[model samples]
Target: MNPPNSLNPALVALDSLPLVVSLAAPIGVAYSGGADSCALLLAAAERWPGQVRALHVHHGLQPAADDFVRVCESVCTGLTLPLQVLQVDARHGPGDSPEDAARRARYTALAAAARQLRLQAVLLGQHADDQVETLLLALSRGAGLPGLSAMAPRFERDGVTFYRPLLQTPAAALRDWLVRQQIAFVDDPSNSDERYTRNRIRARLLPALDSAFPRFRQTFARSARHAAQAQELLVEVAQEDLDRVGNPPAIQALQGLSAARQANVLRHWLLRAHQATPSTAQLAQLLGQIAACTTRGHQLHLKVGSGHITRAGAVLRYTPLGDKAG
Candidate 1:
């Protein structure tokens, strides 16, 4: 069999990502010294000399974390790029996913660093294969439109804009290009730890998808975009529906809407108004209960949010789980 690390002319000529021009004057790149981030940092620095700075988040989760930072510093120094490293506590809760905790902490630290640097946005190296893996993970978890939407190329977090310029390019091509250029980078060992769901998908499923469908990443990304668009439309309709239904949501007003529309409106209200996200099963059950409420005495109670959703006279009210019944 051919080697896994071999490269060809097609890979060499693979498409490059377009940068966001509106990200203010000194562009910040989330450089982890990995092949992907290294390639992105080099390209951005080359395109915008003396205007690109590398921001590295140091999550002290492993023994090699320091090594990663050292490599990143060396690369940035060689490129004559300013490098800033922010150390963070990435410890997860007892029931929390380690990867998720690290990701959230990394973004929080990056946003804080961006504020210190007065940068409005930072570039990330997430690529097409990463997008496909995200889509697959969402599907695996039986997620809704938002989860299937995967990652956006640009998004706002804590007043900082996060841009992923490489979402349209494949990961293999990025790594191959870095190798061909003889640029130095460090491989994070955790990436190959198949215990993580994303890692397993990346190591096993991606190759299978490549063989079964040569252009899977492109099509998968297209599907994610469609899902994102559809979700935005749903959110729009839900907003309109909520305006008509009114806050505290009159039961009579909600009953006038279709079951799907009722769920949409409730989801919008709970999340946007109260910061609560109900599961698909819970939402479906709540919709059924809403349809069954025929009399004033017909009490409805649903365990959702951080609280219980209950019908109080003509309107549905959400009370925190530990609060006394009113």
Candidate 2:
């Protein structure tokens, strides 16, 4: 389905939120009592009543987290919807991106909660501004097609489906809608801190986008969709390439393909077979090394992610750091 293409407050029609949430029934709304989520929750409850579940993940990263939970509880109680608050440890270690760590933790918590609660799908409140920030961040970091594509509207993980029905809606529309309805929502303090790249992008870059391109959120999102489509096609090609190379691909056979195809298939293999993803530079370097492998006696070893891409004779294998090469 094409994402809704406007951030104009009018786009948040009375029925729009309910319309989006109805598509994925028996869904758990990832509620945080923020404007975006509050609007979503209100609409879902009004539309489906007993069908909607409010799932709140308490990251415990901020002092205001407890307050957020209280707000979510109050809203859920008022709406007569069941609320489940899952507190999680979302600390980022040295050298780890806090955003990445928190995201991983959030998803983990969601999956675990979904399993425990036996929910079919989880809905998120991420909006068009988030999409723009993601795309811009991907550009800033020189990420590849996969990164540029950003978040998927719907994806399945750990036997549960995740839906982002508001991806096409802008944050402004959500806030305005809530204001008109006189619904109170808390602004996350951490979101204003520019120490994080996403926060900086949201605060500084978003306004600049508004001035330069009045509807840049939708435009940026369209570009992201294009990138996502392109990435899907590449993934298909990589899958086909993998089928030809056989499992634990033979080094000789892989070296026969072009550099780009080699990179594609290797990326597919690493992610699927080893649960590891590498940077573009790392993939290119690894491809160069594969090209340099001219003899059976030549050793094949390079660090890729938290593992080493090692050659066990003709077969390329991934061994986690410090694991036996077998």
Winning model by lDDT? 1
Number of backbone-clashing residue pairs for each candidate, in the order shown: 0, 0
Give the alpha carbon lDDT tens digit for every residue of 1-326 in model 2. 22353233423433454334444446688898888778777766665668888999999998899999898988888888999999899999999989989999999989888888777677788888888898999899888898899888878888888877777888977887676666678899988999989999988889988999998988888989999999999999999999988789888889889888999999999999889998877888888888888987888788999999877888888998878885
Give per-residue CA lDDT, model 1, range 236-288, as digits (tens). Answer: 99999999999979999999999989999999999988889999889998998
Error of 2 at 195 (Å): 0.9
TM-score per candidate, chains pooled: 0.92, 0.91
Which residue pairs of candidate 1 clash?
none
In model 2, the Cα lDDT at residue 37 comes to 79
Model 2: number of backbone collisions:
0
